[model samples]
Target chain A: MTEASVRRVESLGASELLALYEQMCLIRRTEQAAHDLFMSGMVKGTTHLAAGHEAIAVGASAALRPDDYVFATYRGHHHAIARGATPEECLAELMSKATGLCRGKGGSMHLTKASTGMLGSYAIVGSHLPMATGAAWSARLRKTEQVAVAFFGDGATNIGAFHEALNLAAVWRLPVLFVCENNFYMEYTPIAEVTAVPNPAADRAAAHGLPGIVIDGNDVAEVHDTVARAAAQARSGDGPTVIEARTYRHFGHSRTDPAKYRPADEVERWMARDPLSVARQRLESLGVSADELQQADAHAAGVVEAAVDAAKNAPEADPAEAFTDVWADGGSTWRT
Target chain B: MADVITYRDAVADGIAREMRRDPSVVCIGEDIGAAGGVFKTTVGLLDEFGPERVRDTPISEQAIVGAAMGAAMTGVRPIAEIMFSDFLACCWDYLANEIPKVRYMTGGQVTVPLVIRTANGGGLGFGAQHSQAVENWAFAVPGLKIAAPSTPADVVGLMAAAVRSDDPVVFFEHKGLFASKGEPAPPDHVLEFGQAGIVREGTDVTVVALASTVATALAAADRLAEKDISAEVIDLRCLIPLDVRTVLTSLERTSRLVVVEENPYQGGWGGTLVSIVADEGFDLLDAPVKRIAGACVPLPFADALEDRVIPTADAIVDQIRTLVAY
Candidate 1:
């Protein structure tokens, strides 16, 4: 890690700093286990791992209170865990266990817990941008102090809903934080090949008359400070902010593909800048040791093991539940 | 207790009564305030409730619907207007994705008490751009509740019911029904969602209709009575939560059926009704189901051509005559 980033995380208290490192580790370990299970056919459906993009979700989510709403994309286990979803619940969802957050109905693509104010994890590209803006606008109308955050990939910035949502949020000065996780590749297509502009998608925010902040996605302290200030500004009714975190994906877009689209040297370089290792070194420099880190790891691993066991023992989803939730009253005139 | 009231006036009364009853209800749309609605359905509302409650928004359909969704989720019941039902294509994302799916995706933690009021169908030569009966599109969305009322009373009653519901509702008002006359419905009338009113009863044939087609269906029933065919006409006032029992009862008596609609013939509400009857009451049918609906082509600007596309009383009678023989 760089000297500057090291000093930045060292500024936080021992407990908070230790918790942040452990949280990122939990995300990495849980997702790594999920990747192994998926490859071994222990799980079903498409799984998108957030291996290299941990710092963005962990850092940004640490900025807000529990009342704040967060919208996430399909690659969302990290975002969910960062927003307070337990590692076990998220891991169980990937495994399609009954005790998953959505009772296994949402699986990897859609994990939501509204009680925590985590609005949803949408499967559609860029669809949740407008939804987040709507919720932020609602918060402003109702005079709530809570702000809404929308997290998406760099590819989503090209969709029509993204532009429409950002412009509307700017025009109304809605309390929203638009975070773009620019992981270099948008499902095998390089950012340079698709976007004519720079890598960080935050550059486009200026056109909407909003401030855009670009930070080192791998640096947790920089992401936290940048997002914390932006989130504070939104809660105080100072309009929205666009943050682009430049990062890389450790794995391919899904369970398949060996990331042949990327060069061997590029992967080695990002792996050298691993977020967990960077945070651990910062904590150690601040006098937290390998023994303390091991304790946190044990705690997280225990939590995940308990959660997976509980999920496996949970009851199966009722067949009638498929018909439920479609309507508020459990009735549709079309079905007669 | 009654006077000459246009369908527009009935709608205005509906909105005014809801706003008076609940402080949470408000109106938002283009030209809905001081200028009133495009058809003046919201005239004098801003003066009575003030601009904060009766809002006029930009022509952007996406912004209008999005603002309504935002307002609805935050304890405000907003009655948003799309100016024309045809304009809904511009904001299908807000309609189909964000609004209806909000409560469900959130696992019922929230409720969207919203109403989208728009005029559909063509008769005054607005042509294709301003005219299209796209209620089927709203019906296709799972979380949305839809209704198309044919009478002044039904429109007023259904509007009140829509604003009172906890779910999002799309109220499709036919442009052609604005001037059509009917007995004045109750000023404070409340209409149930899944109930269909049998306007006229006969035994020879059953014709199911909704919205503007209800009037045409009644007229066709009168003509069929003259010819001794005795056609029974059922007005499916509510489109989405269809009153299947009423339709089944009509089918039981008539033993023959025809569906008349203003929407496109292919994959229309007619097909939906046919499938329901075919699955539930196959033995009751004496003839192949006949569907009289709008032609697949867009509504033409020419008056005669427009007339040729929409379902008319003559068209309904022709289909009923063919069904009766079988």
Candidate 2:
């Protein structure tokens, strides 16, 4: 491995490190199970999994306070899991159960838990960035120290909302962290083909007059440390920060995509550096026993399985729920 | 005591009253701060509330509306201005998809108490880019509420209602009506949605209008009276929660309908009103509903051509005469 791939361990305790490992493992196992369920025709609609991008979600979420808000993209199961959404709720949403996060109104692409500060996951690319910035603006106006983190892919950086939100956040000096998960591909097209700049964080941040940092997203510790620092700066009223986390997605853009556009060698190269494995190996090198790591893995697997089983048994949402929640006044005449 | 105030001042007064009543209320838009907005509707707001509440945003409509959505979700009532209704095309996704869908999509986890105020209607000679009325675009969104106030009193009353609504509201202020003077609205007056204002009472033909066309309909009513044909005029204050009851009541009296609007006839809010009347009050109609609307074309810059494209008082009079004869 190159020297850049070797991430230095931070000041986290053994238990904290184990917890991070468990979170990442839980996300992976849950996503894998969700993919299997989709393939078996049990789960309806579509799902965008974050198999390889677990570290960014886990680490960034680990750095945020319980009340800090997180806005994520369609590839957001990991984000929901890391932000304290139980696998049951996440899978229940995918399973279209009434007990789901959005009460099954929002399927896989719109899992949200306001209690955990996991704002709704957006299916439209780069659409939620402004909302995140607006949340930060609200926090500032309310004299609260809450910070909002917007998680999007590399492709979102090219969208107009992305540029507008960044510029507004900077001008208003709102407490927001713009996290870009650079997985190299925006849907099927490679980022290099669409993006005008080499580093999105650097290019976009310069234009908006905000601090930009490109870090190793595969390194959970690095992501945690960088996000922790940025979140601190935001809470202290230093304005927003743009963080470009360089990572990869192990799965296709969606369930049906075989990712035939990607070369076999490139996929193999990234798979070899899987974030979970890298973290596991680092934990082992730090004197963690293999049995302890195995126990964590088993725990994660059990949790995911239990969630799937529970989701399968959860009651279907009432059809009348479609008419509700459309308006606050309870006067929506929309017939189901 | 009611004072004579311009529609622009009425809108500003309504915003100031709301801001004073609620500390969480804020205004964000381009040139709304030190420059007092391109239309000067937001003048003296920066001085009253300071910059923290009155923000001067960059020319970013998507971010402006999106940020307002976020703020509204988090307990702040944001009044964002798009300068011109035509510019809503620039941020259609946020206004159409994100802003309107959030409350419903989140299953009522959040409420977007946002009021997007934009200047609409033609006759200003700003051409297609700045003069086109796009209230129909907002009317099409189910979750969105639309308010188009014609007189100064209605402007303040509707603005208050919009700021106080839990749902997202799109307030279309006609640029032509901004300079027009009317009696000031009562203090703390808040008009409810789906309430129609009867500007003129008649029994020959009922004329439905909104925004700038309300005045035209009234003028046409006066001309129709000279011809011994009295026309009843109804100003539809809000479009989404349409006041069909009032229109139906007028239809029962008049037995004839003529819908007038500044927007094009195809897919216009006037068509929706006509549809409602047709679907519900078909027995009351003495004749088929006639629509007097702008021509289906981009508004041109030239004065004579622009005059032909938009509906005039004469056009409303002619439509009313035809319906009355029928």
Candidate 3:
């Protein structure tokens, strides 16, 4: 979106840039379809959509290796997809299908595919920061070069777990990337009004002895470039980085919210720089044709369509399923 | 025949043996390393295992537990200490919600093989916040294996079992029984999760207890013998994989039961033990089952007041007298 970030976008290959755009499109389509399904009463629980805050997850995910771990929040459709979770599994999970991720037990807020290293999407605010840090510690202890990434919102910075996690990670010099997708609002209220500092995440990074790096989250290239360098730094045994991405959410916090608390101008401002539009512009400026961009968008649309159709056809989560997977042995027995 | 080994020493022995056997096992707490834990349960760990495996973290319960969970998820057997069981409330989200639910929520994609060892029960005169037997908090949550050993051998053996368990275990090491002595645990002794040891078998009445209460119940049984009351004392080693069959079988022989728990009466493990007997072995009961537990209030600070609040040997004997008389 910026002339400076376009320079960063130039680092990515033409095809890699195309893939990032397509990935963002897939997340967008999946969320939009999920929203429709939720309104139609097909989705059982409240769904958190990451429409405007796509590049932060997608760009950051693209920068990491497959073996690296990602700890995401409830608004993590984009992060999950970016970390190799199929749109079908995520949508199927949202619809509570048996074929869904976690077999519909996690519903919307807890979509997890451990095989992909996308550890469960934690619903509690600021809960996963330390978890991701711990995961990084595991990698260090186990002698693996893998890094762990935690995607959270600005609201998490105010919570005690956030500070505790940052302090622990800093002291341990753990290989973790604390990516704060500052969507400007903590559910209904503006984060700035409640938070003490100006930059909630980056401003507090010095206290934890981590480098405070802020980025334009609307620019996928900037997010990818910054995260790539940070991940490399972590992999090389350099400490964790606190990355604050300035972004906004396109929709309400959850299924019921209208997000009328936000100013109309602010919403319009964020909408004007939507991640999808920004990605398209960056692609076109990089000598990509309009027809080529449309094809990628069309492919994304097709993926979402197939995913939604498959999810709808999948059987409902069985009553018996409710009593399964409580233990690692695949049984719900608490007592013998 | 063994020398008197303190219950506190067995805890460290258990962890040290596990750490020796498995390199993946790491211990983390506020003052575990250098300070050797506030209760000295983790003594000699940092010296034996070195600082890499034996770590001391900041006074952040959330950080300690969450980090342990994270490590556990990724093939590390972490033994995290929360100083006091009452402090479990500070990081309860991880214990009650996140840690237990990980395996279930992830559809077994992740296995949380970690142990949370905390100082439990209310006899050290540490007052309400520092001295509550808070295993009841973890008992309500599924996916966690709860272990509260009574003796020195049981402590080492149960600690081995907890560290080695694939399922997350909340091992409640009673603060009150730290100085209490018992037989030394044999080398590499790993206790099973659910086998409730019948420490003292009697046919007149069966009294079930765990942690510090097991000792109190044993003392009560000693006093009850003079009254011609044969009290069978069962030390429930693990609470989650509750050995209900053992409790029910004892009830069948005795035909009367009394659950002695150090946690308050409100949501203690006593309610669960009693319900199992009522539902499955109601015919085994000659009298209404009695629950001799801590009074339903904050554990008072004063020595005498605290004694009144928590079930003492006399209180347990009195409750059984009432149960046996009926």
TM-score of each: 0.91, 0.97, 0.98
- How would you order the candidates by DockQ, starting with the best? 3, 2, 1
For candidate 1, what is the DockQ-based docking class?
A: acceptable
Q: What shift in Å separates residue A325 of candidate 2 from its native position after superposition?
A: 1.1
- Please give the ranking of all candidate structures by TM-score, highest first, separated by commas: 3, 2, 1
* Model 3 ranges with Cα > 4 A deviation: A1-9
Per-candidate alpha-carbon RMSD to the true structure: 3.3, 2.1, 1.9
Please say which candidate is ahead in DockQ: 1 or 3.
3
Model 1, which residues run further than 4 Å from truth?
A1-11, A330-336, B26-35, B45-75, B94-111, B181-188
* lDDT pick, better of 2 and 3: 3
* Candidate 3 local lDDT, B144-170, one digit each (tens): 899999999999989988888888999
Better of 1 and 3 by lDDT: 3
Cα lDDT tens digits, model 1, B23-66, are 88888788999898888889889999997688776566776786
Q: Which is superior by TM-score, 1 or 3?
A: 3
Ranking by lDDT: 3, 2, 1
Residue A268 miss distance in model 1 (angstroms): 2.4
- Please write out the lDDT profile of model 2 over residues B216-304, one tens digit for every residue: 89888888899999889999888877888899999899899988888888888888778878888999988999988889999999999
Give the least accurate 10-residue stretch of model 1 chain A, judged by summed lDDT.
A1-10
* Tens digits of per-residue lDDT for model 1, A34-117: 787788776688889999888888888787888888889889988889888887677666676656776656778887767777
